[model samples]
Target: MPEKSYPMTAEGKEKLEAELKNLKVVKRPEVIERIKVARSYGDLSENSEYDAAKDEQSHLEDRINVVEEMLKYAQVVDATSIDPDEVAVGKTVTYTEVGETDSETYTIVGSDESDPLNGKISNDSPIAQAILGKKKGQKVTIATPGGKFDAIIDKVED
Candidate 1:
């Protein structure tokens, strides 16, 4: 089977790289030091600190591995290359509900950088999927797990 591609914006790639560097240079040493301190606590069998440190090390290593893999397959997307009037990854889209007066805006981003609370949504998300490739002023119906709704594209900024 082929490896899955991880699409992301340049900013997202930078964030991932920074995280990976920190993990290897800073967190790794901290964990090692923690293990050494835990070892000095005597019996490993009865030392809770030692067990906790080992568990933390395991989780940290797992995270580092995942980040490394993601970086290896990352495909940085350039928003400027895409049409400014179209909705696509790395573009911020503003839309209004078909029957509502209020408007909402969200930036379409890769899964690794998606933060719905901050208005960044994953391309795989129902709303993003439905609106991707659509032009500004186009209307789209998005069917999410919560329900379905219609939205009119008001703007698309790269």
Candidate 2:
């Protein structure tokens, strides 16, 4: 089996690298110091502080591993190299629902950078998946848990 590639924009890759750096250079050292302090409290079996610190260490290590793996398989999608007429990862698309009066925009990104509130959506999301590879002005049907709606692609920007 091949490792799954994560498609992300250059900005997304930079953000991930920054987070990883913070985890390794800052969070790791801070957690180590916490563990050391907890150990000095003595009795490991009954020390809640020690237990909590150890648990936190476990979770932190898990998160570090996940981030490392994601970075290792990242495939950077350069927006400038893509066709402005096509919708793809790293492109911001504007569309209007069939019955909606207003148009909305969203930037399709990797799962790691998905922030719906900020208009960044994961490529794996239902709406993104439905519109990927579509051309501007094309009509696409998006199926979500709520219902299905038609989206008319208005614009695609690199």
Candidate 3:
């Protein structure tokens, strides 16, 4: 079986690479130093500090592995190669729900770069999935976990 590819924008891939570098060069050494200090404090059986450092090290290593894997299989999507008027990964899409006066805008990105609070949503998300490949003035029915809603694509921008 083939490994799953991580679809991401070039910017998103860069962010992941930066995170991986920080984890390896900075965080890994910090955790190691903490573990060393904790070990010098004597009895490991009752040492809370030692246990905490070990746990942190475990989490950090897990994160590093995940990031490395993501980067290894990354499939960068270029917004410039896509149609400016169409909704796709790396494109900013604006839409208004039917019967709602307010409009919401979101930049569709990969799962690793999804930050809904910052208006960046994963392309796999219901809203993005509903709008992908769609153009302005197109009506789409978005089926979300909460429920389904009708929305009209207002704009698509790079």
Candidate 4:
């Protein structure tokens, strides 16, 4: 199967790249050093230090592979190009739900950058999908675990 591309902001991409570099250059070397020191303790079977180091090394390698794969298929979505009326990645959308008097705000972003508590939501999410391509004053309804609720487009911003 082909690798799936990830929608990411430039800053989000930089953060991932930084983590990859740290794992490859800094963490990798540090783990190697630890392994070396642990090996000096004698037989590997009874050495808890050696076993722990080996487990850490395995985890580091797995992280490196995951990061590399993410970078390999990254589809950078620039926040600046997003339209004010369209629900695109990196844009903040304002809406009012049915049966609720107050309005709410949420930023449409990549899945990696999404933090519901922080008001950032993945563009591929059901809520975002419900609002995409909609303009101000348009109503959208989406199915959620809480049941279907209607939302009216109030505003969009980047």
Model 3 — TM-score against the truth? 0.95
Which 10 successive residues of model 1 have the least lDDT summed?
2-11
Report lDDT (Cα) of residue 148, candidate 4.
Answer: 86
- Model 1: pairs clashing at backbone N, Cα or C within 3 Å: none
Candidate with top lDDT is: 3
Instruction: Work out the TM-score per prediction.
Output: 0.95, 0.97, 0.95, 0.88
Instruction: Report per-prediction Cα RMSD to one decimal.
Output: 1.1, 0.9, 1.2, 1.9
lDDT of each: 0.94, 0.93, 0.95, 0.86
The Cα error of candidate 2 at residue 133, in Å, is 0.1
User: After superposition on all CA atoms, how large is the RMSD of candidate 2?
Assistant: 0.9
Better of 2 and 4 by lDDT: 2
lDDT of 1 by residue, 32-113 (tens): 9999999998999999999999999999999999999999999898989988898988999999989999999999999989
Residues 54-131 of candidate 3 have per-residue lDDT tens digits of: 999999999999999999899999988988888989999999999999999999999999999999999899998899
- Count of clashing pairs, candidate 2: 0
Put the candidates in TM-score order, highest first.
2, 1, 3, 4
Instruction: Compose the digit string of candidate 2's lDDT tens values, residues 1-158.
Output: 98789999889999989989998899889889999999999989899988888888898899899889999999998877877899999999999999898999999999999999999999999999999999999999999889999989999998
Considering every candidate listed, which one attains the maximal TM-score?
A: 2
Q: Scored by Cα lDDT, where does model 2 land? A: 0.93
Query: Which stretches of model 2 miss by more than 4 angstroms?
Result: none
User: Of the candidates numbered 3 and 4, which has the greater TM-score value?
Assistant: 3
Model 1 ranges with Cα > 4 A deviation:
none
